[model samples]
Target: MQETVRVALDAMGGDNAPGELVKGAVDAVNAKENIQVILVGKEDAIKAELSKHTYPKDRIEIRSASEVITTEEAPVTAIRRKKDSSIVVAQTMVKKGEADAFVSAGSTGAILVGGQLVVGRIRGVERPPLATLIPTTKGVSLLVDSGANVDARASHMVQFAKMGSIYMEHVIGIKKPRVAIVNVGVEEEKGSALVKETFPLLKECSDIHFTGSIEAREIPHGGADVIVAEGFSGNVILKLYEGLGSALIGEIKKGMMSTFRSKMGALLVKPALKETLKTFDATEYGGAPMLGLNGLVVKTHGNASAKEVKNTIFQCVTFKEQKINEKIKACFIKKEENE
Candidate 1:
């Protein structure tokens, strides 16, 4: 029998909080028998949203949290003071083993700070990086330190490569995944100080299939399976990727509706176009997981809707079943043993 993956979900964390979050929890429990969701937020609001949908009563529970963290609040101060906030309560559940994972679409800073402070890091794990799956021509690639550790060192990036490889192989089922450091040019010599320093170390890693440096242009072409970078550059790439994708999609839609002839063509091509476009949809891939944490902590977009919420909850199930944390721990343990 499959063990149930218990998820602590922050019901009041996103723009569509309580309603979309509650609906997502209901959808997940209804769809998967081996999943349980503990909704954490204001009791009245959560209950009101719950009334709008029907789900397995035993599979869904509520843990009342009176406070909510906003984006403007200082992450550290908010986490320290708002002990009863939804993000805090949910992450605490993970820390205590009350839940297998914590999922939130709240303040990104709070999630990062809380994951490190409340949930804590795995043994031997330095700074845990946020690993997000970005769509590529072939399928998807894992971008490590996408929004975490801006001041990451070469050693930290090496660990990111290892962890990213583990996740892609075990959870995403990519065997012997290719690893590459992000650089301005394909040459190992071209990049910022961080990249130049990290390149040689990654190439020498025996555990991972280290490919040479990858240019940003090659990212969409699936040049590498695992792209490693410090948070500053990785975040820039992610934002640009998202912005460009949206702009192109908008232009495509506008062109398709420009004239009567285009409208006729659009009707015939809409199905195929949608199927192609779905591959690039960021929400379809779920939220970014903060790898190397003692327990799983996922941070979705602040505007995440019910679909993204549901997908993220399911992503947690895969992470649990694949024993991702255990594998990551083993990798670090082996490294420690070697050193």
Candidate 2:
């Protein structure tokens, strides 16, 4: 019998609240046979949304969470005070081994705090980084520490590279994922003290194929498979990437609808344009996974729609099936043995 993957989703966490969250959960369970979703939030709200969809009763379960964590509240304070918050309750399920994974489109701070305090970290894993798959010219590349560990050290970046390489190779099916540090220039000497120190360490590692450096401009062009950086710079790159993609898409639509000549061209190329744009859609890849945690914790965008939520729930299945945590533990264990 296939082991069922139970995903506890924070139905009240995102902007759309129970509606999108519940729909996503329902869609995920209906789409996959060996998956189950335990929606965590107010009972009435979730049930009201669930009522809209006809799904298998056994696959979808609801666990009431009286409180909801907001973005304005201090993450640590909220987690400590709101014990019954949907985010906390869902994460607690992961810690208690009741659920295989926790998916939330909540406050990033709250999720990070709950992930560390509640779900905890894998033994020997010093820092868990937020790993997001960014669409590139040649498919996708994994960007590590995009939003977590802002003050990460050189050693932490090395671990990020190691863990990232493991993920891309195992889950992403890249034979030898090329790992690189996000740097100002392609030259080895042109980076912050942290990057300069971490460069040689990555090169010394026989496990990953560490390419020297990747400039921000080269990122969208598929420069490397695993782009490693401390959270501050990584977050900047991510925000700019998202903002630029959105602006370009908006401009493209505006141009296509401007004049009769352009409108005719648009009608002729709408199908092909949509197909190309779908490749750049961030939602298609699902949420970012906080790697190195004992149990999986995925953090999606707060404004995520049902499609993003649904994809994120399914992403958890692949993470569990790949045995990513086991592989990460072995990577650290082997490193310890060598030293």
Highest lDDT against the true fold, candidate = 1
| Span of 10 residues, lowest total lDDT, candidate 1 | 186-195
C-alpha lDDT values of all predictions: 0.93, 0.92
lDDT of candidate 2 at residue 337, scale 0 to 100: 89
Please report the TM-score between candidate 2 and the true structure. Answer: 0.97
Show model 2 residue runs off by greater than 4 Å.
none
Clashes of each: 0, 0
Which residue pairs in candidate 2 have backbone atoms (N, alpha carbon, C) closer than 3 angstroms, thus clashing? none
1-339: candidate 2 lDDT, tens digit per residue: 877999999999878898998989888988999999999999999999998999999999999999999999999999999999999999999999999999999899999999999999988788899999999989999999897999899899999999999889988889899999999898878988888898999899898899899999989999999999899999998999899999999999999999999999999999998999988888888999999998999999889999999999888998899999999999898888888
State the displacement of the C-alpha of residue 164, model 1, in Å, after optimal TM-score superposition. 0.7
Give candidate 1 regions above 4 Å deviation: none
Q: For residues 1-339, write the lDDT of model 1, one tens digit per residue.
A: 999999999999989898899998999999999999999999999999999898889999999999999999999999999999999999999999999999999999999999999999999899899999999989999999897998889899999999999999988899999998888898766888888888888888999999989989999999999999899999999999999999999998999899999999999999998999999888899999999998999999888989899999999999999999999999999989999
Model 2 residue 216 lDDT?
A: 90
